[model samples]
Target chain A: MNGLNGIGVKVVHVGGNGNAHAVLREIEARLQLLVEKGEEGSIDLSGLPLMPEDYDLLEETLGEGEVVAEVHSLGPTRIHETGIPGVWWVTHYNSDDEVLAEFIEVAWCPEILLTPEDDVKDGLEALRARLFELNPKSPLGGAPSLDL
Target chain B: MRDETLLDTLKRRGISRRGFLKFCATTASMLALPPAMAAEVAAALGKVRRPAVIWLSFQECTGCTESLTRAHSPSIESLIFDAISLDYHHTLQAASGHAAEEAREHSMKQDWGNYLLLVDGSIPLKDDGVYSTIAGISNLQMLKDAAAGAAAIVSVGTCAAYGGLPHANPNPTGAVSVSEIIKDKPIINVPGCPPIPAVLTGVLAHYLTFGAIPDLDDLGRPKAFFGESIHDRCYRRPFYDQGKFAKTFDDEGARNGWCLFELGCKGPTTHNACATTKWNGGTSWPVQSGHGCLGCSEPDFWDGGSFYKALSTPISPVTGAAAAAVAIGAAAGVAIGLANRQTKAAAKAAHQKATIADLEK
Candidate 1:
């Protein structure tokens, strides 16, 4: 019990616009209750008890590149339901730094998984076969159109 | 001799053809070239006649020469000088006095605008270049004379590149690099205390095969060797990023092989491939062997700072020990009280033992 310090991860968010104080306050209130109950170790913001409107409040305050959240995983807490094995909480904010965009990317992990040599060959073959069935100059003939 | 192949020359010198090929492979790897390039290097080297090279030594300790000749792996003398037609070297040439000078003169004249110039030290430019003399001529005049008809120049050590030890603070003789004086010819700087022998041979091989100097950086150094900073390729860089530093030589940190960032290692700022290429065939670099890099290759690295101080941290105590002692005693009274009691009992026992011995005498 002497060194039961929780591990907290600080994430510096960049990009997006708006004030972050209100979103921060709401997160603090929710986290404070969890801390009091000794359940503050691993938080699932994706499963947060708060309303979707409240989550929207957070989204509204965030600008791109802003630090929208900090995750704190209490030493003893276990997060069984969220599928992630670790216990952590995220505190969010908004900022304007650019390098974090790679980390912020929506399709980052999927891109990493699909960009390997075998995957690239599979993709190229699919594209090549699709080309025979379509008109060369038509926008939607070879592949899905940009609008869709 | 004129028509001898490189393999035949090596065999004549008792170095096996396979061993000579291994040397070429080692050279290609050292230059960071692909493995496929090794056979091309060997083939190219075998066909060409040895290019004429003239060695010159100026204001130096001849450590470069010592390092070059002492290279036991490939033996710099055999791989470098013998591979090339070293027509005139002051230390190695048989001729003496005016005759030696005359040989150097003849080589430059006969191979005019074709011979390669290898300078081992800096040229003193102050006081009409009277500081360093060779054959009754200042280094400046000799440099001007040699560089006049040379095809290319390779400044062989730190002295020839950044004006080594002689150019430290209060450099009285105004020791300047070869480029500072000889600006006409294409110069390639190979800077180190005594640069790695493989790097030296690699550059020479590149020049021989291509018939022109290799790609150079802004400093006139080859990009293949000097492209990245030492920190970028250092094995201990992960430890540095994690902020795990060795504070002392014999401490637990040092024993764990932690990053030497706290020990004034200039690997972060200095650019060289020593961390990867290493000395004596990838055995170890200075930081790997427990000593920090002193940034020996950079200009004015000798006077930068102490080798053991952290590059960014504060070394001295923020507050005095007396103040810390009082504060610690006040804050942790029980711990201090127990320590003081143990000290007093130990001192009292020693004192009483001394007094009893005096009384008995």
Candidate 2:
């Protein structure tokens, strides 16, 4: 986040230090529940009415990880994997570039990244056509060679 | 030549004597049998003749058959499946046309009243069973005809047990459960969208061991498997007890893997072994995979209102009346307690002391 901050986005710590700590503590409790029971949940930051700076501070508190997924379908949605596995920081930006939504998602990964069964079923015909192309006897593809 | 026994079949299938014994031990434990009973079960199962089974499909999606075939690999459940003399199954049976019907007739006649009838689907009674037909014979007619010669029946899916999805709302087909149709024979309901495979084999094992239907609930489902609700055995139940629920699918609560009760989980009302036995070999269940239960095992689940509706939310007029009844009962309890207190106090006031002087007089 600090490296990306150099690209013109202003950075500052949130005004509500106590609030950030409390929310972090709440999240910590939820994480503990997950570790104990394998139970997961999402905490809506918008409901918390967290300031933009608060979101930044929360991310800083969570620290960073190696993997992140960017989704542009609904809006500019970015999911940042926290240091802890199964914990994620999801943020959404509006058309005007203002933060419209935020959530601390606790799961293996964000559900939005996964392809649904119905969608896959809808694409089956096209996928099957590709399958035909990869077939050995088909004109689009060739047979396997004797030497491996 | 003598008919091959279960032990013979297992050995033929390359399962060692030790492996076979281990399965018997596991089965004994799963069925809650005594530790010493494992040896008995092993001996009984080994020497027992393969019992004939006839599987009939009707108004079903063939999901039950799929669940059975796809149970955990190299498991004894599958071995029992292979060991059983499945004489006729519409889905899995290779024979077709009149040949298949002939095979079914032959088995029924040969086995007489000894073959186990494993039925998976509702018997449609509407329009003389015109909604569904096989080989020009109605499902109702076939069921009645087959049930006559069956020792016992195992209703394999929710459809056969409780007139599942097909019986939901309007119920155009006039679908009925196996119990509703055939009352004389002992019937065991293994209700689920598709019940866990081990549970299916578990019933088979019980039959093989004891030569009778397992102890059943009022609904005729085996008490061993259908004894508990999905909610009771669910891993997510702690969150439910804590009142933490996912209001939306993609919410923080959901991502955090809270209870799905708020998202319309039917686990509380639904009775099945999905939470414990699980699907895909105990890897995950509907709740664990982030979805609320559809309550597929229970009677008329589809008609119980929207699948996404929360349990706490009133789904019908009965819910409101029930809540009001609770309030009235509580008020009555308080009124009765007050009256009792007054009566006790009056009795205390009315009490007369019997003195030693009075006694002497």
Best by TM-score: 2
Model 1, CA-based lDDT: 0.64
lDDT of 1 by residue, B201-261 (tens): 7688787655678888887889888777777766667677878888888788787667888
Candidate 2 structure quality by residue, lDDT tens digits, B115-219 = 899999998998899998999999999999999999999999999999998888788899988889998999999998888877788788888766678889888
Question: In candidate 2, residue B133 scores what lDDT?
Answer: 93
RMSD of 1: 24.0
Off by over 4 Å in 2: A1-148, B1-4, B11-14, B29-37, B316-361
Docking class of 1: incorrect
Q: Cα deviation of B256 in candidate 1 (Å)?
A: 1.4
Candidate 1 residues lying further than 4 Å off, grouped into runs, are A1-148, B1-24, B75-80, B313-361
Candidate 2 local lDDT, residue B190:
92
lDDT of 1 at B350: 77
TM-score of each: 0.58, 0.61
Error of 2 at B357 (Å): 68
Candidate 2 lDDT score at position A147: 29
Quote the lDDT for B103 in model 1: 92
